[model samples]
Target: MTLFFLPIPVNSPLPDLTLADILERTIELSQTAAVILKSYYRGSPAQLEVIDKAEGPVTVADKAVDRHLLDGIQAMCGDSCGYLTEETYQAGDFQLPQDWVWIIDPLDGTRDFIDKTGEYAIHIALTYQHRPVLAVVAIPESDRLYAAIAGGGTWNITADGVRTPIRVTGGKELTKLVVVASRNHRSEGLVKLLAQLPCQQQLKIGSIGCKIAAILEDRADLYVSLSGTSAPKDWDLAAPELMLIEAGGKFTRQDGSLLKYNQGDVNQWGCLIASSGEWHQQILDACLD
Candidate 1:
């Protein structure tokens, strides 16, 4: 692993690297983490050992990749920023975060990975003052990576290192909308909400990163989550949100409230709506009213 993420002095300001420099290095770092996953991922579901957690079934790959990312970043940028990762944040005390935060979900779709569904993804976001400025979502199975930096737009990075800028399919007719949703976490309450959408189709995809990538790449038009008896944390939303937004999309509560990261509470509960930008209000009005 090249560890291109951060090789700078400690206590620095979010690395003096330009956004382009940071974005490229983060893309490289994502593939390194993906290698950790690929090494342990056998074709069979029972290949890796897993332990049940209050959150979900966490596999050894999750911890290994988390350690890889954490150790790599901390070794390079000690005290430069605070971290709020899925596997580690809940184990410790949660407090107000620093001005700079790296929100990570090492393995976002663990169930999909275990099932060999190939819909899982890795999310890494760098936030400043509680807003994401750079984001990357790497889907190793599909060989597709989505990335964005504030004011710089989003790109689809292929396995062979090709980069193509991407954006959302801005607003469509209600009946023509394609919904990108969960494959595993589908709940009855969520089903009811989906039934009301009048969308052209509902595609079951795993991981918020994947769902948002679908929107950013124009594979789908919208994704809405009602918490479904459980809510996604900051790690789940931050990166994908920035990716979609830079791609000319919007992500927020159904009531139109924007999400803030690194807050005291980790959970981002309630109706989280993500859509191609222009028609997002239609989703809110259609569902909430």
Candidate 2:
């Protein structure tokens, strides 16, 4: 087996590492997470040990992967950097020192994982100055990894380590657009909005990462989330948001505001849209009451 490791900048602090360096390290970390997730997933069903949380169901695999990612990030970046993750994050966790913060979802689609669907993923993103600067999304089931840096473009990496550049399809007519939505958390508001869209096709998928992957791979043109009382948290959006933007697509609130990270409130309390930059404005207009 080839052992993958992140090379810490010699005699330099984490803050000194360039965005490219951070992107490289994050990819390595995500690959490690892929191994952990695949191991748990291939085990007997009994090993899942599902537990209910106020937000939803969590499994032993979720917590274990969360701890591993948190510890590994802290070890590499130092404890001074802020950390926010789906498994262990608290409401106020984002208030910590934030020169740099890691926003992560150890297992992005726990529901899908528990249901034996292979659409779940691991997300890790580095946010600086309230914006994601680097990100990695690992879909272990497909043995594929997606990564991006703020201005460096996006790429897909296969299990064999081959990298291919990826981009969103250029603007298509609304009637020809293909939309994807969350499989497990569909909302009535989203359904109503989708009805208004001129999209010709729709798909329901399990993970935020997978839905975003569809857009990146040109399999889908847009992903929409219409939130109600509870909304997606920082961990859910950070990594995928960066990847979409880097792939020449756009992700934003329904009102067209950019997502800001490391805020005390982790809940993204509003409708969100991801689209190939071409139809973003039109989609937002269609959603208007």
In terms of TM-score, the best-performing candidate is 2
Please provide, for model 2 over 1-289, each residue's C-alpha lDDT reduced to its tens digit, 9 standing for 90 to 100. 1122334222222667655666677788888888988888999888999998778899999988899888877877886578888877754644656667888999999999988889999999888767887789999999989987766678899988888878888867788998987788877877888888877598888999999998888888888888886888889999999999988999999889999987788888888999988989988988785
Best candidate, lDDT: 2
Clash counts per candidate, in order, are: 0, 0
lDDT of 2: 0.83
lDDT to native, each model: 0.81, 0.83
Instruction: List runs of model 2 lying over 4 Å from the truth.
Output: 1-16, 92-94
lDDT of 1 by residue, 70-126 (tens): 887665557977888998876533664577788889999998888788888999998
Superposed by TM-score, candidate 1 places the C-alpha of residue 95 at a distance from the truth, in angstroms, of 2.7
Q: lDDT of model 2 at residue 275?
A: 93
Candidate 1 global lDDT: 0.81
